[model samples]
Target chain A: MKSRKSLGDSEELKEINISPLIDMVFILLIFFIVTTVFVEEPGVEVQKPKAASIKDLEKNSILIAITAKGEIVFGGGQIGIGGIRPTVRRLCAQEKLPVILQVDESAPGALVVRAIDEAKLGKARAVFISANPI
Target chain B: MAIKRNFASSEDMTEINISPLIDMVFILLIFFIVTTVFVEEDGMEVSRPEPSAVQTMEKDSINFELRGTQVLMNGKNIGLGAVRAQVSRLIQGQDLPVIITVGEEASAGLLVRVIDESRLAGAKNVSLAGS
Candidate 1:
């Protein structure tokens, strides 16, 4: 019985404690999960123009995309410039969010201006053009 | 009998101490939660010219035209590299309104670049002419 007690003591000393490691892993996992922001694509991809004055946009704003072919896309559907005003009005009425326009580099200037005009008619608080930082 | 009972109870209390480990984990978790910055996608801010807005041609106003791929200042075709210099020289010591007139067929990218260059040159009131 004395020999068995010594042997058990030695085995206990050799055992590694993994509770701290498990706690560390759990902390890391929760950190990533809390900080991760899910970015939603606008369904249509366009080459964003580069600019020097780009600023971080608000996350909860409405997104309007203009394709290289001058197609206006909103909420995963192709919409006309006329449709922008009403949609923006409704969305802004619900939540006063800024409007962001993601215009393709090759899109016509007139279309972008028209979209801006419609967004203004909708009484958007602010308008932004999406561009990559130079 | 009392000594044997005390030894058996001491052996039973062999579990690892984890209170400090849990405290460290909680501190780390709180640090991460506090330091995390939830930054969203970014964009360049542009404001629409107000309708019924007065069109006042200030003495120090500079006109930048975006036609095709060329950037024109006062009707002279200047490269994009020279825009800042030209705008800075024209503004002198006065706050100038830089008006950008974009052609219908001109790419929006060109317009944005010209606006950025003008802003870089310290033009305070930059406005896009309604097409």
Candidate 2:
């Protein structure tokens, strides 16, 4: 009888209380959810020009990249100047996010201008050109 | 409450299965951790002139024409280094609109640098035009 009672005691001790673990996990999950901003990133990188008159832009805005070869990229795919208006319009319809143009230093000015004009036609709240601050 | 029934079922009813809940929470945590971007971009707003909003050029407005890699004012080449000094001197104490007419083949980098210099020189309204 004593051996059986000891076995029961060991079993009870083996059931480690996991409520605290669950509570910790819950806190972490909440933290991540609260701090997440679901902005679609442009996958390609470009050599941005350095400028003294730059400021921090909104974190939740649309990002479009212009490569040195004059390719307009949005969310890892190459899009033409004609694509800007529809893409920006579709995104802005869900939420009014500003459009950010990350242009390579050597990119063509005409393409950049067309992209900006298309973004405006898409009803972007504002348009910005990304540059590295000196 | 039935005391006899509760006593018989005490061991089995005390613990609830939470492995699935934990699995779900872990998945959510991993997804968010992966998607988070820590780099906040620094940029400048570009207000391009629209055809409908074209107003008559001011008498004191400054005109800059960017062709290829050269910056020309009234067909005279002013090197990039001279942009700031010349603009500051030209603006003096008045707010003059600076208009940059960019050729289709001009480099975006040079245009941006010129715009930055013009702004630094205290031009209140810097606008772009296409040639």
Per-residue lDDT of B1-131 in model 1, one digit per residue for the tens?
99999888889887757778777776776666665657466677776544433365444468777788988876799979999999899888687678777788788888788878888888877777654
- Please give the RMSD to the true structure for each candidate, in Å: 7.9, 5.2
Q: Assess each model's interface with DockQ, reporting 2 decimals per model.
A: 0.36, 0.61
Candidate 1 DockQ category? acceptable
Give the per-residue lDDT digits (tens) of candidate 2, residues A1-134.
Answer: 99999888889686787889889988988988888888888899899988998889998899999999999999989888889999999999977889999999999987887888899899999999999988
| Per-model i-RMS | 5.0, 1.5
Candidate 2 CAPRI grade:
medium
* Predicted structure 1: lDDT: 0.79
Candidate 2 local lDDT, residue A117: 85
**Candidate 2: deviation at residue A115, Å?**
1.4
Best by TM-score: 2
lDDT of each residue in B46-105, candidate 2, tens digit only: 877645435655455788889899999878999788888888999997977788888888
> Residue B29: error of model 2 in Å?
0.9
Task: Compose the digit string of candidate 1's lDDT tens values, residues A1-134.
Answer: 99999888889676677777776768685866566544334678889899887788987677889998999998789888889999899888966778899989999887887888889789898888998987
